[model samples]
Target: MNSAKKFFQNLAKYLAVALLVFIIVSPIYWILVCSFKPTRELIRVTPTFVPHTVTLFHYVGLLKETGFMTYFLNSIYVATGSAVLVVILTSLAGYSVYRCRYLGRRFFFNILLAIYIFPRVLLLLFLYPMFARLNLVDNLLSLVITYVGITAPLNVWLMRAFFTSVPLELEDAALVDGANRLQILFKIFLPLVAPGIAAVAINSFLMSYGEYLFASILIVSDRFKTLPVGMAQFLQQYEISWGWLASGSVLIILPPVIAFAFVGRYFVKGLTAGAIK
Candidate 1:
């Protein structure tokens, strides 16, 4: 009877985990199936999970008829650039504060942390005038600037915590070997924190990839539109064309999905590195 009870418990646990995984992945699977289906097929009375009349029409239409390809390229450039830039800036900034001792450091860093939790919408209003004065409105560069600022704080905080766990002895030994600060960072310290750095890259990529709020407000022209804003317009314009929208959306979401799949382990490691230790 005890063995029987244990078997049931194990079965229940496996069932629960399977259900959770299915829930998480079902939407993505649905989206992919819909992307390949014909519009008529997608909206059939009895929806089929597999595409009955699979067509590349949606994918081809998205690229040819709409400016989706351009939007895709813009998003890629922005996301990649933002990820690289933020990782560099935040890593450097966090390392400085985390490892170096200086005056007013705690006060300044505390203020940054406080500011980190505030609403980002506040910046849209406050910086509207400043951005207009600088002629940055509707500019991709402006998007970069906004994204960098938006991403930097939380990433810095994450990185600061990550850097705290690096053993001081490693750094001290490098210093004893007559390595300069830059040498110590690039050669020894940065390599040690590469997992955390990859995590930062993942965070920055996702933020700059799929974010809607700031992109919607800041970018007004079709020429400068990123994927999220483009998705909204594409959906509204092709409201009746479910397949097209779904395909476009699936395509739009692909990059971040690929990025996370490749570096997801690093993100998990970085997030839990100090937490467990």
Candidate 2:
């Protein structure tokens, strides 16, 4: 009876997880279907789960007719730049907080945590005026700086956790071998925390890539607009092109999905370990 009960509980858990997965993935599946379906099929009263006729018209239109490629490239530039900056600054900051003894270290960490929790909307009010004063408004560099500021604190905490888990004896041995602080950081410490770095990179990349609010507010010119902002232009005052919108959505997700597929295991491991530690 106990064995049977255990089996039933396991089955129940599996069913619940399957249901949750279906709920989350359903929208993605629908968007993919809509992307391939022609305009006639998309606006039907009843939606079809599977497309009878798959067409690449929307994809072709997005690439050939619109400024999608420009937006895509812009997103790539900003996301990559922001992620690199976050990783570099966070790694150093994390190591310093973890290893170096300093006055107000705890206070500094508390401030970071507080910033991490603070609503981003609140920061925008302050950030905009400062950027405007500096003539940084509507600039890609401004976007990169904002993204780094938003993502770095959390990433710093993640790296700090990973750094704390590194064995101090290893650093001591490296020190004994005449390795300097930078050498120890680059050669010895970095390898051990590679998973954490990957996690931070993925997080930073995704955050900047998909961020709409700041991008929309900061970028005005069509030349500098990111994917999310560019795609939103489809929903104009008069009409919405569902097909092109779906195609853009599909395209936007592809890079992140491919990235996560490669580093997913490490990302999960790093985050879980950091949280536990």
Candidate 3:
């Protein structure tokens, strides 16, 4: 009877988890399905879960007609630049906070946490004017800088946690062998915390890739606009191109999905790094 009761409990738990997953994933699945469906089928009174006619019309048009490729490349540059900068800056800062003895180290970390508590939009008030003065207002560099600022504070905190998990004995041993701070950081600490670095890269890239508000306001020239802002151009005053929108959405989601797919194991390890030991 106890075994039978435990079996039913486990069954119920699995069923609940399955239901939650379905609820979360069903909308994304619908968008993928609709991206390939023709306009007539998309606008039909009755919804069809499966497309009777699968067409690549929207995808082809999206590439050929729109400046999507430019926007895509722009997003890639900005996001990649931002992610790299964030990883470098945060890893150094986190390591310093973890390893160094300083008077205001706790105070510095508290300030970072405090900055991260506020919405990034609020920073734009000061950021826009500063960038405008520096002639970076319409530049991709501005976006990269903005993303690093927003992503770095939180990532520093994350990296610091990872840094703490590394035993100090390793650092002492490296010092005993006459290795300098940079060598210790590069050879000993970084390799051991590689999962954490991957996690930070993914976080920074995703944040920069999909950001719309700052991208829209900071970028003036159509040529330099990121994917999110460029995608909004599909919304004309008269009509919204649902097919193009759906197709674009599917394409925009691919990079982050691919990144996570490749590095997801590392991300999981990063999060659970110190949990067991």
TM-scores of all predicted structures: 0.93, 0.93, 0.93
* Quality of model 2 by C-alpha lDDT: 0.88
Q: Please say which candidate is ahead in lDDT: 1 or 3.
A: 3
Model 2: weakest 10-residue lDDT segment is: 232-241
- Whole-model Cα lDDT of every candidate shown, in order: 0.84, 0.88, 0.89
Q: If candidate 2 were superposed on the true structure by all CA atoms, what would the RMSD be?
A: 1.9
Q: Which stretches of model 2 miss by more than 4 angstroms?
A: 1-11
TM-score computed on alpha carbons, candidate 3: 0.93
Q: Per lDDT, what order, best first?
A: 3, 2, 1
lDDT of 1 by residue, 1-277 (tens): 9999999999999999999999999998999989998877887899998877888998998788888888888898888889999999988888878888999888867866786677888987876667788999888887888888888777877675568889999989988989998999888999888878988999998989887887888888998899889878877875467877788878877888888999888777766764565
Q: Candidate 1 local accuracy as lDDT?
A: 0.84
Clash counts per candidate, in order, are: 0, 0, 0
